[model samples]
Structure formats: C-alpha cells, structure tokens
Target: MPLLAADNLSLERGGRQLFRDLSFKVFPGQLVQIEGANGAGKTSLIRILAGLSRYGYEGRVSRSGAMLYLGHHSAVKALLTPRENLAWHVSGEADFSDRDIEHALARVGLYGYEDVPSHALSAGQHRRVNLARLYLSQSPLWILDEPYTAIDVTGVGELETLFAQHARAGGAVLLTSHQAMAVDYPVSRLDLTAGIAS
Candidate 1:
C-alpha cells in the first residue's frame, strides 16, 4: 500500500494558480523527488502533502503510517543545544535516550557541538542538527523540503546513502531538492511544472 496519496490537489497564491488537479502517491520503498522551478509551488505542494498547510488548498491527503517532515527552515531553537533539540523535538517524537540523540547528532557531523548553543552554530551546522532527526526517526515516511540547502558536498552524499538505505529497508522518502541525487537507488520524480509523476 502507498504510504501517502494526494487527490486532485489545486492551489492558488497571489492571484496566480500554481498548480491544478495535481495528484500522486508515494509508496513504500520509493524515493520520490518533487521537481519544479522557484515559483512553481514545490514547497507549497510539499507542505500540502505533509499536512502542514491543510486549509489553504483543495485536496485530500491520506497517510498510512507515521511520517517525519523536515521543512525548508532549520526549525532549531536558537537557545537550545543540538542534543536538546532532538530530545524535545517539536514533531512530538518519542523520548530517546541521551546516547541515541548524541549518536544521531554525530552521524550528521555535530558530534562535539551537541551541547553547544544553536545560536553559535553556522547555518550548515544548524541544518545538520535538523538532519540528525532523519537518523533517529522511526517513521515509515519522510517528507523533506529543501533538505540540501546548507549541506556540504560530503553531507549531501551521506544523505543520498541514507535515503537509499531507507528505501531498501521498506521506508519511503519524498523530498524537494534542486541538487540532483547521485545515489545507486532509483529515484522517482514528480515534476510540478509538468504536473506529472515519472
């Protein structure tokens, strides 16, 4: 069964129609990328699918299991440390032990900075803190928006490997990224510009 499905989605912003009658399904073990130009409503579409913007559009979104959504913003609190952010995530994830949180931070290259204030970290480091959630998440579906924004080349490669691993493990990932993936796994594309999934 599909992890998530969108039916007849349509959106209009600022008197401009971004998309109309858009629909797609994200199934288990699939890595899907939402593709579009800057003003093509990629983020809008992702937000709709993730159930973050429920009232503004016309569509029905259904999910089969728990999901993890990482939006374009880092969403890290400036006063909190990396460890604290993961320990008390806004997504309401289950309580994880200190060891697991630190390990996840380490995987995303925030090992020693786990206790450092988020205000002192660079943009990329803040992004890493958000990426750490991917490692700790047990959700079957991951919906990420612009996940590669501040990551380094090596970090990007690591994320690709992680995505591939997730798909191989019967999990699904739906993300919006301008950088083309260079992984060994097959990536399905949902081009918002063309209103088609391929």
Candidate 2:
C-alpha cells in the first residue's frame, strides 16, 4: 500500500473553493512535489495530509506510518539554542540523546552554533536548524511546506542530498517548494493547478 493516499479530496477557504476531487498517492522512496500557483491550496492540501485539518474538505486520506511535518514557519523557539531546540523538538516522539542532537546540528552546518540562541542565527541558519529535524526523524513519511525558504545554495544542496538519501532508504517525502529541485531521484509531481496527477 502507498504510505499515504488521498481520494477525492477537496477544500475551501472564505467560501472560496480552493480545490476539488483531487487524488494522489505517495509511496515509499518517492519524492512527491505539490505544485500550484499562489492561493492554489497547496498548503491546505498538505495540512490535510498531515492530519492537521479536515474542514471544508471531502476525502479519504489515509496513512500507514509516522509522519514528520515542517510547515512554512521554522517552528523553533527564538530563545533556545540549536541543541536545546532540537532536543525539545523531537523529545515527544524519539528519545534523542545528546549525541544525536549534536550530530543532526552538525549535519545541518550548525555545529558551533549549538549553544547559541536561534535569534542570533541568520534566517538561513534558522531554517537549517529546523531542518535538522529531518536527520533526527525516523518517520517514514515527511510532509514539508516551503522547506527551502531562506536556504542558501549550499544548504539546498545538503537538503537535496538528504532527500535523496531518505528516498533511497525507502522513506517518502511530500513537499511544496517554488525553488527548483535538483534531486537525482525520480520525482512525481502533482500540480494542483492542473488537477490531481495520475
């Protein structure tokens, strides 16, 4: 079975029909991109898949495993250091040790900034710190929205590598990004403007 499946999905906002009758499946090792113009309900669709919303939607959305979600916001505490933040972020789902937190930070190029408050980091750095959750996460499915925001070219390369590694390891990623992707893995795109993709 696909890691996630959405059948005949629909949603509305402010009485405006954002999308309708959309369907798609995300399988293990697949990188699925959700594409659309502004106000095309891309973020709304992702929220439903993440189980964060069900209003004004009709659909059977199902998933078989754990899912990690990173929305538009970085979702980090400004006062907390990278190490403290990561430890706090994943503490609910996984028992991440200090070594694990440090390792994830290092992978995201935040090694020396581990103890510095997030507010001190640049926007890109803040985004990278949040992305370290990808390394710490063991979820089979990842739902990310605008994850590349504020990321530099080097950071983008690193993230693309991480995405490829995740897919090669039989994990799946569903994401929305305006920036072009340079991943080596085959990508399946669901363009909301064009309706559901087969």
Candidate 3:
C-alpha cells in the first residue's frame, strides 16, 4: 500500500479552482516533491495532504500510516526553549526521551542553545528548532511545506541527508522546496503549475 494516495483531488479557493482532478501517490522509500509557481496553491495542497486544511476539497486521501508535517512558518513558541518546543511537537507511536530530544537538537546544530528561548534565536535557528522534531518522528509520511525557508547552506545539506536517510529506510517524504535537492535518493516531482489554468 502507498504511504499516501490522492485520488481525483480538486481544490477551490475564492471560487476559483486551484487544482482539478489531481491524482498522485507517495510510496515507501520515495521522495515526492510538490512544485509550483507562486499562487499555484502549493501550500494549500500541502495543507490538504497534511490534514490541516480549513477549506473543503473534493477527493479521497488515503494514508497507510502516520504523517508528520512541517509548515512554511516555524511553529515554535517564542517564550519556550528549544527543548520545550521540541517536547511539545514530538508525537506519534514513538515515545521520545529527554536524551532523544537533546540528540535531535544537537543534530540540528543547536548544541549549546537547547535551553535558550526561541525568540532569542535567529530566524534560521528558530527554523532549526522546529525541524528538530523530524528527528524524533517515526511517521512514514512527512508533509513539508517550504521547509527550506530561512535555513543556511549547512542546514540545508543536513536536511537533505536526513530526508535521504528516511527514504532509504522505507519512509516517504512529500515536500515543496524551490531549491533543487542534492539527496542521494531518487526524487519525483509533481508540478501544480503544469495543471493550473492560467
């Protein structure tokens, strides 16, 4: 079974159809990239797949396992430390220990900054704090919307390695990134702009 399947998916916003009859699937050990020009509804499509969409759409979305989502904006609490934010964001079947959380933080290069409030961190650091949750997730499907925002070169490389590792381990990732990936695994792209009506 596919990790995620979208059958005849159609979404409308402000009475205009953003995408129509779009069908796709993310299988195990695969990386599916969602791409589009601005206003092509990339974020909307990601939200629908992540099950966080507010607007109704026509389609059937099937998931074989749990999904983790990272949005374009960092969801960290300004007043909370990175440790606290990661603790609140970690979920799913796997339980994360404090050591696991610290390891995740270190993986994201936040070694000495774990206890610092997120508001004090730079924009990229804040993003890293939010992304640390990915290390603790065991979800088979990851829905990421513009996950590269505010990340530096090193962080981007680390994330690409992380995604590649996930795919190699039979997990799947669905993400939107304007920057071309350098992952070792194969990546298939779904371009929303190709089907959108101009």
Candidate 4:
C-alpha cells in the first residue's frame, strides 16, 4: 500500500469550497509538494491530511501511525523553554530523554538556546526551536505547511539536509512552500491550480 493516499478529497472553509475531488498518493521515499498560489486551499488540504479536519471533507486517507503534521505558524510556545515546548506537544506515549531533547535542540541549531524562553530568542531561533521536534518525532510521514516561514538560511539548509535523510530512511513528506526549493533528491509536485484548470 502507498504510505498515504487521498482520493476524491474535498475541503471547505468559511462555508466556501476550497478544493474538491482531489486525488493523490505518496509512497516511501517520496516527497510530495503541494504548490499553489496563496489562498488556494493549501492549508485546508494539509489540515485534512493531518486528521484535524475530520468532518470538513469527503474523502479517504490511508496512512499508518507514523504521521507528523506542522502548520504555517510555529507551534512552539513563547513562554516555555524549547525543551519544555516540545515536551508539551510531542507524545507522552513516546519516551525521549533529556539527551534526546538536547540532541534535537543541537541538530536544529538551537544548541545553547535550549533553556531560554522562546520569547527571548530571535525569529530564526524560535523557528529552529519549532523544528527541533522533527528530530525526535520518528514519524514516517511529515506533512508541513509553510515550514520555511521563520528560519534563517542556515536553518533552511539544515532542514533540507534532514529532509533528505528522512526520505533516505523510507519516510515520506508532503509540504507547501512559497519560496522555490531546489531539492537534490527526488520530489514530485502536485499543482492544485493545474488540476482545477484541467
């Protein structure tokens, strides 16, 4: 079976239809990019992919347990330390020790900023803190919407390296971005507007 599949999917927001009858599939080692102009339902589509919009769409999504979803805004809490912020949202079912958290922090370029409240950090540092969770998530499917919003060039390169590593490990990613990316790895893109025009 494909790692994840969406068939005849539809999503609406504010009582307006965002997208309809969309079908797609993602398999192991594949990175699926959803490209569209702003307000073309990218966020809504990801919400359904993440299972956060259960009743807002009519479709079938087949996926296994290892799915992680990140939205446009960094979910990291401003009042908490980076370590504490991750601890709150990541699963209690999974056990990640202090070492794991520390390593994750370091990997995302937040090495010395781990203990500081996120509000004290710069925008890029805050984004790195948000991305640190990916190191420990261990999910096979990563669905990110505008994941590049707040990071610096170094952090973006780090993220691309990490994404390449994940795909090498048979993981899958579905993401949206406004900035053009040159991925050195294999990637397939689904142009939503093209589908609509056709």
lDDT for residue 94 in candidate 3, whole number 0-100? 65
- Top candidate by TM-score: 1
lDDT of 1 by residue, 86-171 (tens): 78883477767888898999999998999999999999999999999999889999999999998999999999999999999999
Q: Local error of candidate 2 at 76, Å?
A: 0.8
Tell me the lDDT of model 3 at 64: 90
Tens digit of lDDT per residue, candidate 2, span 45-161?
999999998575888899999999998888889999989888998998879889999999999999899999888988888888889999989999999999989988888898988
Question: In model 2, where do residues sit more than 4 Å from their true spots?
Answer: none
lDDT of each: 0.92, 0.89, 0.89, 0.81
Distance from true location, Cα of 62 in model 3, Å: 1.1
Return whichever of 2 and 3 wins on lDDT: 2
Using TM-score as the yardstick, the better of models 1 and 3 is 1
Of the two candidates 1 and 2, the one with more favorable TM-score, higher being better, is: 1
Taking all chains together, each candidate's TM-score versus the true structure is: 0.96, 0.95, 0.94, 0.90
lDDT of each residue in 1-198, candidate 3, tens digit only: 799988899999998888999998889999888888888889999888888899999998888988888999999999999999898888444678889999999999999999998889999999999899888888888999888899889888999999999999999999998878888878898889896321
Q: Report backbone clashes per prediction.
A: 0, 0, 0, 0
lDDT of 3 at 185: 78
Tens digits of per-residue lDDT for model 4, 1-198: 577888899777788777888988888898878888888888878888888864557888878767888888888788999889877767553888888888989998778877998889887777777788788877889999888887877777878878888989999888988776667897788877675421
Could you arrange the candidates by TM-score from highest to lowest?
Answer: 1, 2, 3, 4
Q: lDDT of candidate 3?
A: 0.89
**Backbone-clash count (model 1):** 0
Residue 85 in model 2: shift from native, Å?
0.6
- Candidate 1 lDDT at 162 equals 98
lDDT of 4 at 14: 85
